[model samples]
Target: MAFEGLASKLQETIKKLKGKGKLSEKDIKEAMREVKLALLEADVNFKVVKNFVKDVSEKCLGNEVLESLTPGQQVIKIVNDELTKLMGESESKLELNSNGISVIMLVGLQGAGKTTMAGKLALKLRKDNKKPLLVACDVYRPAAIKQLQVVGKSIDIPVFTMGDQTSPVDIAKASIEHAKSIGCNVVIVDTAGRLHIDEELMDELKDIKEYVNPNEILLVVDSMTGQDAVNVAESFNSKLELSGVILTKLDGDTRGGAALSIRAMTEKPIKFVGMGEKMSDLETFYPERMASRILGMGDVLSLIEKAQEAIDEEKAQELGNRMLNQEFNFEDFLSMLEQMKNLGPLGKILEMMPGANAKELKDLDLSQGEKEMSKIESIIHSMTLEERRKPSIIIASPSRKKRIANGSGTSIQEVNKILKHYELMKKTMKNMKGMQKGMQKKMKKGLFGKLPF
Candidate 1:
């Protein structure tokens, strides 16, 4: 939901264009005007917004677009391409040292979640078969060192620390030696942060940078700060020559001006983003995928990646076979629920789906859905194995239904509703399988299916 407001507005504006078989200059101008207002209202930097609208207008007004059979689609493609360009066109990777240990210095303001991002990055590297050493360089903040230690401990990564009395520069230099001694290939230094930018803090960071000569100087910023986040990145890049940025709390940023404007303003790529509170929630930033999401075109590639990470292929196949054979039961239902939960929030999952607009998504009460799922689970748990496998028997036996209702702390009416819905779902699945087979036949005859959107 990072760009909910902007995405909704852009999607609505483009929806109008898509409805037209032929477009005029007046129509393109009207759409661009709406887009400009949306970006400005989302808190984008004024100059960035102005340049973006100008570039998009120029491309959309070309004869190739205005004279094309699908003028609206052409305009969308142009906007998508320009949006990707605005955010650094491609993914920016972390700099790795080939000869020796790769050292990364995390720089940011105090409330930017730098310590947590260090743990997240270290966790990611550890998963990628690199031995990472986390160095405690923030000795000023109360409990900052202890917090990093806690993070390192949770992730099972080793933390190197000297006493608070030691200067950060010495600590960073010594950490590299420790990493070499232990054969750690990556060193992540969690540096101190000030409430606001200050000369003293900058001097300290610069001193540490001189001592360590880090491979990557990543600035972590809070995306919810909007234009202030962009301004902060500019300030940090000026002093540190920052290699990239890590935007934290992106899930909480609805306006998303900082994400859209930072790279344009600082010429720095966003290497990573903090999507959720979990250490595993840090994701590499992909500009093209983000642009697609912003325009409501959906990010199918990211959705597939998330599914690949969260689901077991063999189990999924097995479950599919069961459904096809009409053998799916309460156990399979519970297992599928667990797997879906692993894919993150339902709202986020819907955002990656084609044609799922912001208004409809906002109307989806995920918490209420979760509550309903919990109730179903409780009902299923109260059933006997035989009843789970063959729900018809329970439906036929009023006594059994009453027993389950008592066990699940619900009325018999709720039990009937659960059974009714389960039957409806099975019936729907059967119809879908039949439709899929029909589509397969058509596909074999050289017919391609159209997208639902």
Candidate 2:
């Protein structure tokens, strides 16, 4: 969703190149021109866009690409490579101090989701087996300390806070000793931010930096701010010598600017990205994987990782066996829906699919799909246990359908649609089971020589 417009345009431009069996210099020039426009329209910094286009165009014009068996694919690969390089070329992990507590100072302008990011990062570190302490250092904003406390409490992390009367520099310094006493291996200082970059803000941040000597000075930036985000990063880097950046609000209607421009502009790798408002939505930023997604090449690795984290392997296997054995029912279907919800939104899953057309996905009303899923869940929940296990009974009785419709607050026709869909799914599983049995019989007869009889 962040790069919807740019991805659509880039995919369309590449599609034309893919259709051409051979490419001429003129063809590549035209494609590059289109790409240049797309990036600019995406609000990518002008200098970054220029350098990206120049590099891609030169690579595409190379003889290796021009004479390749599949010139179109070669060109796409070159674009992908350039895109990755533009976004820091690799993942930049947090440089924690192995010997003692790692201090990370988070700095950003106001309204960049800094407080929430602190909780997310601490939670992530805790999952990695580190005891993390969150320090509330934002003494200026109203309720800033309270916000940090609430966030830390929700995540079950300790939040070290002095009152708003204390200077942030002093609060940050005190948090370290507090962390040491509690055996926290990592201390994340949530610093204050101003409406804009100012000397007072920088001086205060500098004071905290001087006091803490943090292992990381990560600048939290709102990715939706486009070039302004880049400018903020540049200013902060100039003052603080930042270790990395954490982009927030990337799930919003972002134009793909900050993510593409920050690293090229500031020479800092993006450490993490805030994908949603949920505490668990912070994801490690992988340049190669992001490039693949931008090129319509699907981030299968991230998708699989998400599945492994969210889906229970035992439950998934049981569900799979039930489906293959043609025993899937409304109960199983409900379980499947709950599992799917854990994988995140359907639109995001679609975005990770290989060759998914951004325009086509945009045309789909994903919110409506979410509502339909809720409706289906409601309809299923309204059914009796017997009806759930044996949907055939509901199918045969109109009165049963009427009862379910009334319980779910829907029309009978809607209830009927759900029943029909369930029947179709069961029929499909039955047919697949038959095909599998047939294949197994043939395999035993031919490959195993009648099982050594």
Q: On a 0 to 100 scale, what is the lDDT of residue 249 in model 2?
A: 87
What lDDT is reached at residue 426 by model 1?
87
lDDT of 1 by residue, 349-419 (tens): 88888777876676678788778878888888999999998888998999999999999998899999988
Global lDDT of each candidate? 0.91, 0.92
> Considering every candidate listed, which one attains the maximal lDDT?
2
Candidate 2: pairs in clash: none
TM-score of each: 0.88, 0.92
Candidate 2 on 1-453: residue-level lDDT in tens?
Answer: 868988999999999999998999999999999999999999999999999999999999999988888999999899999999999888999999887889999999998889999999999898889999999998889999999999999999999999999999999999999999999999999998874458887899889999889999999999998999999998898888999999998888447999999999999999999998889999999999999988899999999999998899999999999988878899999999999899999999989999888898889899998999999999999999999999999989999999999999998999999888877887899999899999999887798785655
Q: By TM-score, how accurate is candidate 2?
A: 0.92
Model 2: lDDT equals 0.92
